[model samples]
Target: MAKSRFRSTTEHTMDSKGRLNFPSRFREVLNQYDSEILMVAPWGKNHLRAFPLPEWEILEDRLMTEGREKPDLANFIRYVVGGVAECSLDKQGRVQLPVQLRTKVSLAKNIMLVGMIRHVEIWDKEIWQQDNEATSENFDSFNEQLSQMGIF
Candidate 1:
Protein backbone atom coordinates (compact mmCIF):
# COMPACT_ATOMS: atom_id res chain seq x y z
CA MET A 1 0.00 0.00 0.00
CA ALA A 2 1.09 3.54 -0.59
CA LYS A 3 2.06 5.63 2.42
CA SER A 4 -0.73 7.49 4.11
CA ARG A 5 1.02 10.82 3.77
CA PHE A 6 2.95 12.40 0.92
CA ARG A 7 6.38 13.90 1.64
CA SER A 8 9.03 15.20 -0.75
CA THR A 9 9.76 17.99 -3.21
CA THR A 10 10.65 18.09 -6.87
CA GLU A 11 10.78 20.70 -9.60
CA HIS A 12 8.84 20.57 -12.87
CA THR A 13 7.77 22.94 -15.58
CA MET A 14 4.37 24.10 -16.64
CA ASP A 15 3.76 23.69 -20.34
CA SER A 16 2.43 26.42 -22.58
CA LYS A 17 -1.03 24.89 -22.19
CA GLY A 18 -0.87 25.32 -18.41
CA ARG A 19 -0.42 21.62 -17.92
CA LEU A 20 2.14 20.17 -15.48
CA ASN A 21 3.62 16.77 -14.97
CA PHE A 22 2.33 15.48 -11.66
CA PRO A 23 5.17 13.82 -9.77
CA SER A 24 5.20 10.07 -10.30
CA ARG A 25 5.33 9.35 -6.59
CA PHE A 26 2.33 11.55 -6.05
CA ARG A 27 0.51 9.71 -8.84
CA GLU A 28 1.15 6.39 -7.14
CA VAL A 29 -0.31 7.75 -3.93
CA LEU A 30 -3.34 9.02 -5.82
CA ASN A 31 -3.79 5.62 -7.40
CA GLN A 32 -3.71 4.03 -3.97
CA TYR A 33 -6.47 6.41 -3.00
CA ASP A 34 -8.34 5.38 -6.16
CA SER A 35 -8.48 8.82 -7.68
CA GLU A 36 -7.14 10.51 -10.78
CA ILE A 37 -9.13 13.66 -10.30
CA LEU A 38 -7.98 16.42 -7.99
CA MET A 39 -9.21 19.73 -6.66
CA VAL A 40 -6.61 22.43 -7.13
CA ALA A 41 -6.93 25.73 -5.35
CA PRO A 42 -5.05 28.73 -4.11
CA TRP A 43 -3.22 28.28 -0.83
CA GLY A 44 -2.41 31.58 0.77
CA LYS A 45 -0.82 33.95 -1.76
CA ASN A 46 2.14 31.87 -2.84
CA HIS A 47 1.10 28.38 -3.86
CA LEU A 48 -1.57 26.08 -5.26
CA ARG A 49 -2.64 22.98 -3.39
CA ALA A 50 -3.86 19.82 -5.09
CA PHE A 51 -6.13 17.49 -3.15
CA PRO A 52 -7.14 14.13 -4.43
CA LEU A 53 -10.87 14.10 -5.11
CA PRO A 54 -11.50 11.46 -2.45
CA GLU A 55 -9.49 13.37 0.12
CA TRP A 56 -11.13 16.65 -0.81
CA GLU A 57 -14.59 15.17 -0.49
CA ILE A 58 -13.82 14.10 3.05
CA LEU A 59 -12.63 17.58 3.95
CA GLU A 60 -15.66 19.15 2.24
CA ASP A 61 -17.98 16.91 4.16
CA ARG A 62 -16.36 17.89 7.43
CA LEU A 63 -16.58 21.57 6.60
CA MET A 64 -20.22 21.20 5.70
CA THR A 65 -20.97 19.52 9.00
CA GLU A 66 -19.00 22.07 11.01
CA GLY A 67 -19.74 25.21 9.06
CA ARG A 68 -23.47 25.05 9.70
CA GLU A 69 -22.91 26.30 13.22
CA LYS A 70 -19.94 28.59 12.57
CA PRO A 71 -20.16 31.60 10.28
CA ASP A 72 -16.41 31.93 9.81
CA LEU A 73 -16.20 28.27 8.88
CA ALA A 74 -18.74 28.84 6.15
CA ASN A 75 -16.72 31.70 4.78
CA PHE A 76 -13.64 29.51 4.73
CA ILE A 77 -15.62 26.93 2.78
CA ARG A 78 -16.48 29.54 0.19
CA TYR A 79 -12.93 30.78 0.00
CA VAL A 80 -11.53 27.32 -0.66
CA VAL A 81 -14.20 25.14 -2.24
CA GLY A 82 -15.70 27.97 -4.22
CA GLY A 83 -12.49 28.62 -6.12
CA VAL A 84 -11.39 25.03 -6.51
CA ALA A 85 -10.70 23.70 -9.99
CA GLU A 86 -11.42 20.08 -10.65
CA CYS A 87 -8.59 18.66 -12.75
CA SER A 88 -7.92 15.22 -14.09
CA LEU A 89 -4.62 13.76 -15.17
CA ASP A 90 -4.28 13.06 -18.87
CA LYS A 91 -2.94 9.82 -20.35
CA GLN A 92 0.57 10.95 -19.54
CA GLY A 93 -0.33 11.88 -15.93
CA ARG A 94 -0.35 15.57 -16.62
CA VAL A 95 -2.85 17.85 -14.88
CA GLN A 96 -3.67 21.34 -16.01
CA LEU A 97 -3.61 24.16 -13.55
CA PRO A 98 -6.15 26.80 -14.45
CA VAL A 99 -4.82 29.89 -16.19
CA GLN A 100 -6.34 32.23 -13.63
CA LEU A 101 -4.75 30.32 -10.78
CA ARG A 102 -1.39 30.45 -12.50
CA THR A 103 -1.68 34.19 -12.87
CA LYS A 104 -2.99 34.71 -9.35
CA VAL A 105 -0.02 32.96 -7.77
CA SER A 106 2.51 34.21 -10.30
CA LEU A 107 3.39 30.68 -11.31
CA ALA A 108 5.85 30.65 -14.17
CA LYS A 109 7.39 27.91 -16.30
CA ASN A 110 9.74 26.67 -13.57
CA ILE A 111 7.86 25.38 -10.55
CA MET A 112 8.19 23.18 -7.52
CA LEU A 113 5.92 20.29 -6.57
CA VAL A 114 5.94 19.88 -2.82
CA GLY A 115 4.30 16.96 -1.06
CA MET A 116 3.00 18.49 2.11
CA ILE A 117 1.54 15.44 3.88
CA ARG A 118 -2.19 15.95 3.34
CA HIS A 119 -1.86 17.69 -0.01
CA VAL A 120 0.62 18.56 -2.69
CA GLU A 121 1.50 22.21 -3.17
CA ILE A 122 2.92 23.84 -6.31
CA TRP A 123 5.06 26.90 -6.02
CA ASP A 124 6.95 29.23 -8.27
CA LYS A 125 10.67 28.85 -7.68
CA GLU A 126 11.28 32.42 -6.61
CA ILE A 127 8.17 32.58 -4.45
CA TRP A 128 9.05 29.31 -2.79
CA GLN A 129 12.47 30.67 -1.96
CA GLN A 130 10.94 33.67 -0.28
CA ASP A 131 8.31 31.65 1.55
CA ASN A 132 10.80 29.06 2.67
CA GLU A 133 12.97 31.76 4.16
CA ALA A 134 10.05 33.16 6.12
CA THR A 135 8.95 29.76 7.35
CA SER A 136 12.45 28.85 8.42
CA GLU A 137 12.63 31.97 10.55
CA ASN A 138 9.45 30.96 12.33
CA PHE A 139 10.33 27.30 12.84
CA ASP A 140 11.71 27.66 16.33
CA SER A 141 8.67 29.49 17.63
CA PHE A 142 6.33 27.14 15.84
CA ASN A 143 8.07 24.11 17.24
CA GLU A 144 7.84 25.51 20.75
CA GLN A 145 4.12 26.15 20.45
CA LEU A 146 3.48 22.83 18.75
CA SER A 147 5.21 20.96 21.54
CA GLN A 148 2.49 22.11 23.94
CA MET A 149 -0.03 20.37 21.72
CA GLY A 150 1.85 17.05 21.88
CA ILE A 151 3.33 17.52 18.41
CA PHE A 152 6.95 17.47 19.41
Candidate 2:
Protein backbone atom coordinates (compact mmCIF):
# COMPACT_ATOMS: atom_id res chain seq x y z
CA MET A 1 0.00 0.00 0.00
CA ALA A 2 1.18 3.52 -0.65
CA LYS A 3 1.98 5.10 2.68
CA SER A 4 1.55 8.64 1.49
CA ARG A 5 -1.66 10.33 2.52
CA PHE A 6 -3.34 13.04 0.49
CA ARG A 7 -3.65 16.06 2.77
CA SER A 8 -4.28 19.38 1.11
CA THR A 9 -7.00 21.52 -0.33
CA THR A 10 -6.67 23.50 -3.52
CA GLU A 11 -9.04 25.86 -5.24
CA HIS A 12 -9.28 25.64 -9.02
CA THR A 13 -11.45 26.71 -11.87
CA MET A 14 -13.07 24.73 -14.58
CA ASP A 15 -12.38 25.89 -18.11
CA SER A 16 -15.19 26.88 -20.40
CA LYS A 17 -15.01 23.47 -22.00
CA GLY A 18 -15.79 21.90 -18.60
CA ARG A 19 -12.35 20.56 -17.92
CA LEU A 20 -10.65 21.20 -14.59
CA ASN A 21 -6.99 21.01 -13.77
CA PHE A 22 -6.22 18.12 -11.43
CA PRO A 23 -3.47 18.72 -8.88
CA SER A 24 -0.10 17.35 -9.99
CA ARG A 25 0.54 15.51 -6.76
CA PHE A 26 -2.84 13.82 -6.81
CA ARG A 27 -2.28 12.78 -10.39
CA GLU A 28 1.06 11.29 -9.47
CA VAL A 29 -0.62 9.06 -6.86
CA LEU A 30 -3.07 7.81 -9.47
CA ASN A 31 -0.15 7.03 -11.77
CA GLN A 32 1.60 5.12 -9.02
CA TYR A 33 -1.43 2.84 -8.83
CA ASP A 34 -1.06 2.27 -12.58
CA SER A 35 -4.37 3.83 -13.49
CA GLU A 36 -5.83 7.22 -14.01
CA ILE A 37 -9.35 5.92 -14.09
CA LEU A 38 -11.55 7.45 -11.38
CA MET A 39 -14.90 6.32 -10.17
CA VAL A 40 -16.79 9.51 -9.59
CA ALA A 41 -19.86 9.21 -7.44
CA PRO A 42 -22.13 11.64 -5.72
CA TRP A 43 -22.60 11.56 -1.99
CA GLY A 44 -25.99 12.87 -0.93
CA LYS A 45 -27.20 15.75 -3.09
CA ASN A 46 -24.47 18.24 -2.27
CA HIS A 47 -21.08 16.80 -3.06
CA LEU A 48 -19.17 14.39 -5.23
CA ARG A 49 -16.30 12.06 -4.43
CA ALA A 50 -13.67 10.34 -6.53
CA PHE A 51 -11.55 7.29 -6.01
CA PRO A 52 -8.88 5.99 -8.30
CA LEU A 53 -9.99 2.68 -9.80
CA PRO A 54 -7.74 0.52 -7.66
CA GLU A 55 -8.65 2.29 -4.46
CA TRP A 56 -12.31 2.16 -5.38
CA GLU A 57 -12.06 -1.54 -5.93
CA ILE A 58 -10.82 -2.00 -2.40
CA LEU A 59 -13.74 -0.02 -1.05
CA GLU A 60 -16.11 -1.95 -3.29
CA ASP A 61 -14.82 -5.19 -1.89
CA ARG A 62 -15.41 -4.11 1.69
CA LEU A 63 -18.86 -2.75 0.94
CA MET A 64 -19.84 -5.88 -0.92
CA THR A 65 -18.61 -8.13 1.84
CA GLU A 66 -20.59 -6.27 4.46
CA GLY A 67 -23.52 -6.06 2.11
CA ARG A 68 -23.88 -9.80 1.85
CA GLU A 69 -25.69 -10.03 5.14
CA LYS A 70 -26.69 -6.46 5.77
CA PRO A 71 -29.53 -5.39 3.56
CA ASP A 72 -28.89 -1.76 4.38
CA LEU A 73 -25.32 -1.97 3.22
CA ALA A 74 -26.42 -3.80 0.10
CA ASN A 75 -28.89 -1.05 -0.75
CA PHE A 76 -26.32 1.65 -0.15
CA ILE A 77 -23.71 -0.21 -2.15
CA ARG A 78 -26.20 -0.47 -4.97
CA TYR A 79 -26.74 3.25 -4.93
CA VAL A 80 -23.05 4.08 -4.77
CA VAL A 81 -21.89 1.63 -7.41
CA GLY A 82 -24.84 2.35 -9.63
CA GLY A 83 -24.24 6.07 -9.61
CA VAL A 84 -20.64 6.22 -10.76
CA ALA A 85 -18.88 7.55 -13.81
CA GLU A 86 -15.50 6.27 -14.84
CA CYS A 87 -13.28 9.22 -15.67
CA SER A 88 -9.82 9.81 -17.00
CA LEU A 89 -7.84 13.00 -17.35
CA ASP A 90 -6.67 14.36 -20.66
CA LYS A 91 -2.99 15.06 -21.40
CA GLN A 92 -3.38 18.64 -20.21
CA GLY A 93 -3.99 17.53 -16.62
CA ARG A 94 -7.60 18.38 -17.13
CA VAL A 95 -10.62 16.14 -16.68
CA GLN A 96 -14.06 16.71 -18.04
CA LEU A 97 -16.58 16.44 -15.27
CA PRO A 98 -19.45 14.44 -16.64
CA VAL A 99 -22.53 16.59 -16.99
CA GLN A 100 -24.58 14.17 -14.94
CA LEU A 101 -22.15 14.28 -12.07
CA ARG A 102 -21.69 18.00 -12.34
CA THR A 103 -25.40 18.46 -11.99
CA LYS A 104 -25.63 15.94 -9.18
CA VAL A 105 -23.23 17.85 -7.00
CA SER A 106 -24.10 21.31 -8.27
CA LEU A 107 -20.49 21.66 -9.28
CA ALA A 108 -19.76 25.24 -10.09
CA LYS A 109 -16.83 26.56 -12.10
CA ASN A 110 -15.08 27.50 -8.89
CA ILE A 111 -14.57 24.64 -6.52
CA MET A 112 -12.18 23.03 -4.10
CA LEU A 113 -10.46 19.69 -4.41
CA VAL A 114 -10.02 18.23 -0.94
CA GLY A 115 -7.87 15.28 -0.16
CA MET A 116 -9.55 12.83 2.23
CA ILE A 117 -6.79 10.29 2.76
CA ARG A 118 -8.02 7.59 0.42
CA HIS A 119 -10.22 9.56 -1.95
CA VAL A 120 -10.86 13.00 -3.32
CA GLU A 121 -13.88 15.15 -2.64
CA ILE A 122 -14.87 17.94 -5.01
CA TRP A 123 -17.03 20.48 -3.33
CA ASP A 124 -18.95 23.54 -4.29
CA LYS A 125 -17.38 26.30 -2.23
CA GLU A 126 -20.63 27.36 -0.61
CA ILE A 127 -21.57 23.85 0.36
CA TRP A 128 -18.17 23.11 1.83
CA GLN A 129 -18.48 26.13 4.05
CA GLN A 130 -22.00 25.23 5.02
CA ASP A 131 -21.10 21.66 5.83
CA ASN A 132 -18.20 22.66 8.03
CA GLU A 133 -19.92 25.42 9.89
CA ALA A 134 -20.93 23.14 12.72
CA THR A 135 -17.81 21.00 12.70
CA SER A 136 -16.00 23.17 15.16
CA GLU A 137 -18.97 23.24 17.48
CA ASN A 138 -19.39 19.49 17.24
CA PHE A 139 -15.76 18.52 17.44
CA ASP A 140 -15.94 17.13 20.94
CA SER A 141 -18.97 15.01 20.12
CA PHE A 142 -17.33 13.77 16.95
CA ASN A 143 -14.07 13.17 18.76
CA GLU A 144 -15.77 10.96 21.31
CA GLN A 145 -17.03 8.70 18.52
CA LEU A 146 -13.61 8.60 16.92
CA SER A 147 -12.09 7.68 20.24
CA GLN A 148 -14.55 4.84 20.63
CA MET A 149 -13.39 3.60 17.27
CA GLY A 150 -9.78 3.80 18.43
CA ILE A 151 -9.01 6.35 15.76
CA PHE A 152 -7.75 8.92 18.27
Candidate 3:
Protein backbone atom coordinates (compact mmCIF):
# COMPACT_ATOMS: atom_id res chain seq x y z
CA MET A 1 0.00 0.00 0.00
CA ALA A 2 1.05 3.57 -0.51
CA LYS A 3 2.16 5.60 2.46
CA SER A 4 -0.01 8.40 3.71
CA ARG A 5 1.09 12.00 3.59
CA PHE A 6 0.47 14.19 6.59
CA ARG A 7 0.23 17.88 7.21
CA SER A 8 3.07 19.67 8.98
CA THR A 9 2.86 20.96 12.54
CA THR A 10 0.26 23.60 13.23
CA GLU A 11 -0.60 25.65 16.27
CA HIS A 12 -4.30 26.23 16.82
CA THR A 13 -6.55 27.48 19.52
CA MET A 14 -9.31 25.51 21.11
CA ASP A 15 -12.37 27.57 21.87
CA SER A 16 -13.71 27.69 25.38
CA LYS A 17 -16.43 25.31 24.32
CA GLY A 18 -13.84 22.58 23.53
CA ARG A 19 -14.02 23.07 19.81
CA LEU A 20 -10.81 22.92 17.80
CA ASN A 21 -10.50 24.42 14.38
CA PHE A 22 -8.28 21.99 12.53
CA PRO A 23 -5.87 23.36 10.01
CA SER A 24 -7.40 23.50 6.53
CA ARG A 25 -4.54 21.47 5.13
CA PHE A 26 -5.24 18.69 7.62
CA ARG A 27 -8.90 18.68 6.67
CA GLU A 28 -7.88 18.08 3.09
CA VAL A 29 -5.96 14.99 4.21
CA LEU A 30 -9.03 13.60 5.97
CA ASN A 31 -11.12 14.24 2.87
CA GLN A 32 -9.16 11.54 1.07
CA TYR A 33 -10.43 8.86 3.41
CA ASP A 34 -13.65 6.93 2.98
CA SER A 35 -15.54 7.69 6.19
CA GLU A 36 -14.17 11.12 6.94
CA ILE A 37 -14.11 9.72 10.44
CA LEU A 38 -11.21 10.53 12.71
CA MET A 39 -10.46 8.38 15.73
CA VAL A 40 -8.88 9.82 18.86
CA ALA A 41 -7.21 8.36 21.93
CA PRO A 42 -5.04 9.46 24.80
CA TRP A 43 -1.31 9.51 24.05
CA GLY A 44 0.90 9.41 27.11
CA LYS A 45 0.91 12.19 29.70
CA ASN A 46 -1.06 15.05 28.23
CA HIS A 47 -1.85 14.57 24.57
CA LEU A 48 -4.40 13.06 22.23
CA ARG A 49 -3.73 10.94 19.18
CA ALA A 50 -5.77 11.23 15.99
CA PHE A 51 -5.91 8.71 13.18
CA PRO A 52 -7.92 8.38 10.04
CA LEU A 53 -10.55 5.67 10.05
CA PRO A 54 -8.58 3.37 7.78
CA GLU A 55 -5.41 3.67 9.78
CA TRP A 56 -7.30 3.12 13.03
CA GLU A 57 -8.93 0.02 11.60
CA ILE A 58 -5.58 -1.38 10.59
CA LEU A 59 -4.32 -0.91 14.12
CA GLU A 60 -7.44 -2.45 15.61
CA ASP A 61 -7.13 -5.46 13.38
CA ARG A 62 -3.56 -6.03 14.44
CA LEU A 63 -4.45 -5.75 18.08
CA MET A 64 -7.30 -8.19 17.71
CA THR A 65 -4.99 -10.82 16.33
CA GLU A 66 -3.78 -11.54 19.85
CA GLY A 67 -7.23 -11.62 21.43
CA ARG A 68 -7.52 -15.42 21.57
CA GLU A 69 -4.65 -16.10 23.96
CA LYS A 70 -3.47 -12.94 25.67
CA PRO A 71 -5.58 -11.48 28.44
CA ASP A 72 -3.48 -8.35 28.55
CA LEU A 73 -3.94 -7.87 24.83
CA ALA A 74 -7.66 -8.29 25.25
CA ASN A 75 -7.71 -5.61 27.92
CA PHE A 76 -5.69 -3.27 25.76
CA ILE A 77 -8.09 -3.81 22.88
CA ARG A 78 -11.01 -2.97 25.09
CA TYR A 79 -9.38 0.15 26.47
CA VAL A 80 -8.32 1.51 23.12
CA VAL A 81 -11.57 0.64 21.42
CA GLY A 82 -13.64 2.09 24.21
CA GLY A 83 -11.75 5.34 23.91
CA VAL A 84 -12.39 5.62 20.17
CA ALA A 85 -14.80 8.29 18.93
CA GLU A 86 -15.79 9.45 15.51
CA CYS A 87 -14.87 13.01 14.61
CA SER A 88 -15.84 15.11 11.66
CA LEU A 89 -14.83 18.55 10.60
CA ASP A 90 -17.64 21.06 10.57
CA LYS A 91 -18.29 23.48 7.74
CA GLN A 92 -15.85 25.83 9.35
CA GLY A 93 -13.23 23.07 9.39
CA ARG A 94 -13.51 22.68 13.13
CA VAL A 95 -13.76 19.57 15.27
CA GLN A 96 -15.25 19.53 18.72
CA LEU A 97 -13.14 17.32 20.95
CA PRO A 98 -15.14 15.38 23.49
CA VAL A 99 -14.83 16.90 26.94
CA GLN A 100 -13.30 13.78 28.45
CA LEU A 101 -10.51 13.77 25.90
CA ARG A 102 -9.87 17.48 26.26
CA THR A 103 -9.59 17.20 30.01
CA LYS A 104 -7.47 14.07 29.80
CA VAL A 105 -4.94 15.94 27.73
CA SER A 106 -5.14 19.08 29.83
CA LEU A 107 -5.76 20.94 26.63
CA ALA A 108 -6.72 24.54 26.94
CA LYS A 109 -6.67 27.27 24.33
CA ASN A 110 -3.24 26.86 22.77
CA ILE A 111 -2.58 23.44 21.24
CA MET A 112 -0.11 21.80 18.91
CA LEU A 113 -0.96 19.31 16.17
CA VAL A 114 2.08 17.19 15.36
CA GLY A 115 2.19 15.01 12.29
CA MET A 116 3.07 11.38 12.77
CA ILE A 117 3.38 8.99 9.84
CA ARG A 118 -0.03 7.37 10.27
CA HIS A 119 -1.65 9.85 12.63
CA VAL A 120 -1.49 13.27 14.22
CA GLU A 121 -0.91 14.01 17.87
CA ILE A 122 -2.68 16.87 19.64
CA TRP A 123 -0.73 18.22 22.56
CA ASP A 124 -1.10 20.93 25.15
CA LYS A 125 1.25 23.73 24.20
CA GLU A 126 3.27 23.52 27.39
CA ILE A 127 3.67 19.79 27.24
CA TRP A 128 4.74 19.94 23.63
CA GLN A 129 7.40 22.45 24.51
CA GLN A 130 8.84 20.25 27.21
CA ASP A 131 8.63 17.14 25.05
CA ASN A 132 10.35 18.89 22.19
CA GLU A 133 13.15 20.04 24.44
CA ALA A 134 13.81 16.54 25.78
CA THR A 135 13.73 15.04 22.31
CA SER A 136 16.19 17.63 21.04
CA GLU A 137 18.57 16.86 23.88
CA ASN A 138 18.50 13.14 23.09
CA PHE A 139 18.51 13.41 19.29
CA ASP A 140 22.15 12.62 18.70
CA SER A 141 22.18 9.57 20.93
CA PHE A 142 18.90 8.31 19.57
CA ASN A 143 19.98 8.70 15.95
CA GLU A 144 23.25 6.94 16.58
CA GLN A 145 21.45 3.99 18.19
CA LEU A 146 19.02 3.75 15.28
CA SER A 147 21.87 3.91 12.81
CA GLN A 148 23.54 0.96 14.54
CA MET A 149 20.43 -1.04 13.73
CA GLY A 150 20.59 0.09 10.08
CA ILE A 151 17.34 2.00 10.57
CA PHE A 152 18.67 5.36 9.41
The positional error of residue 91 in candidate 2, measured at the CA in angstroms, is 0.7
**lDDT of candidate 3 vs native?**
0.81
In candidate 3, the residue pairs with backbone N, CA or C atoms under 3 Å apart (3 or more residues apart, or in different chains) clash, namely none
What 10-residue stretch in candidate 3 is worst by lDDT? 1-10
lDDT, each prediction: 0.88, 0.83, 0.81
lDDT of 2 by residue, 14-59 (tens): 8767688889989987787788898888877888888988888998
Q: What is the lDDT of residue 109 in candidate 2?
A: 81
Q: List ranges where model 3 is wrong by over 4 Å.
A: 1-4, 67-70, 148-151
TM-score, per-candidate, Cα-based:
0.91, 0.89, 0.87
Top-scoring candidate (TM-score): 1
TM-score attained by model 2: 0.89
Comparison by lDDT, 2 against 3, better one = 2
| Candidate 2 C-alpha error for residue 59, in Å | 1.6
lDDT of 1 by residue, 10-117 (tens): 989899999999988899888887889989988767899999888898888888887788887766677778889999999999999999889878999999999988
Instruction: List residue ranges in candidate 2 displaced over 4 A.
Output: 146-152
